[model samples]
Target: MKTSRILAAALLAVGSGLALHAANAQQAGLHRTDLLQQDIGLPGREAIQVRVDFDGGAVSIKHSHPGEEVAYVLEGSLEYQLEGRAPVTLNAGEALFIPAGVAHVARNVGSGKASELATYIVEKGSPLVVPAE
Candidate 1:
């Protein structure tokens, strides 16, 4: 009985620590600002622009979008990895294009805040992004 109680307590402590870590990660995750969005006169398609800021150690999980994405680095640097391709480091003034439906992840690998301007050509009614399974 004593051993079981000790195991329970240990589990509870680890669970609490994991909860705290998740909360902190959420606080330090990506910050995005919508810059522009407009219809391009194509049925169900729109052009959207956004600025994404990543704090140090920030990382985005594998995800995919329904449309083409183009990102331009605005400050600092990041590592972008697309499915089946080697990860590439992108610095300020550099740009990358991701074809629609490709899984990818991005991480801020610099010591300071990193930012990028992202433009998407996507269907108007679809989710802008979705996590990959």
Candidate 2:
């Protein structure tokens, strides 16, 4: 009887361990993914972050996972200033790339409110704006 009880206990322990493993796997854990900046409502989208700073630049930020971000100046010219790099200017139908984790800011140098559209494919669970000092 003692031997049978010991065998049953061992089985129960193993079963519990498997249950825990399965539970952990079922939890929401982000992985490498391709995220379009637009919110087209396709599927499996975590978040779609789009911002339009009309002729007004915001505080430049950095990130952890490093992203490949590209911007298209739609309305007017944009002066993109980056850390440790020369400032670049782009006009309508022009585009620029901001490398991963590099501090950068954009300003509309052209008259009127300049508009630009940027898209990014970021690693899952990583924020769009990772603060940089």
Candidate 3:
């Protein structure tokens, strides 16, 4: 009975670990890694940096930030659609600027995967990303 209980416990631990890994894998299609966040010299403002990776055909939902964003493509190709502006496709080493509060979407247009280094300068204490229509 003791041996059986030990075996069951081991199996349960492995099962939970696999469940956690699966959840993470699902989110790997669109991954964001924050690199830095710091209070800037400007009063009431902060600067943030993040690396975002998108699998082929993956897209970020329409969203807006409280401040300006500088998106620099690190790898692959991505298309950006900003509200009321023409969609722009950027390749590796390309970049774009997004105005504060402008709704936009980013889609991976490459054959495999795409990545971007996003830098933001925004108001402090406010949400970095807000969902937009």
Best model number under TM-score: 3
Residues 40-109 of candidate 1: C-alpha lDDT, one tens digit per residue = 9888999989888998988986788879999999999999999999999999999999999999999999
Number of the predicted model whose lDDT against the real structure is largest: 3
Instruction: Put the candidates in lDDT order, highest first.
Output: 3, 1, 2
Off by over 4 Å in 3: 1-28
Full-model lDDT for every candidate: 0.85, 0.57, 0.87
Per-residue lDDT of model 2, residues 32-102, tens digit only: 12234443353433333343445344222222223667777777677887888898988889988777677
Can you tell me which runs of candidate 2 are displaced by over 4 Å?
1-51, 56-65
Off by over 4 Å in 1: 1-28
- RMSD per candidate (Å) reads 12.6, 14.2, 10.2
Candidate 3 lDDT by residue in tens digits, 1-133: 9999999989876875565355335453788787988999999999999899998999887888999999999999999999999999999999999999999989998999899999999997666777785
TM-score: model 2 vs. ground truth: 0.56
Greater-lDDT candidate between 1 and 3: 3
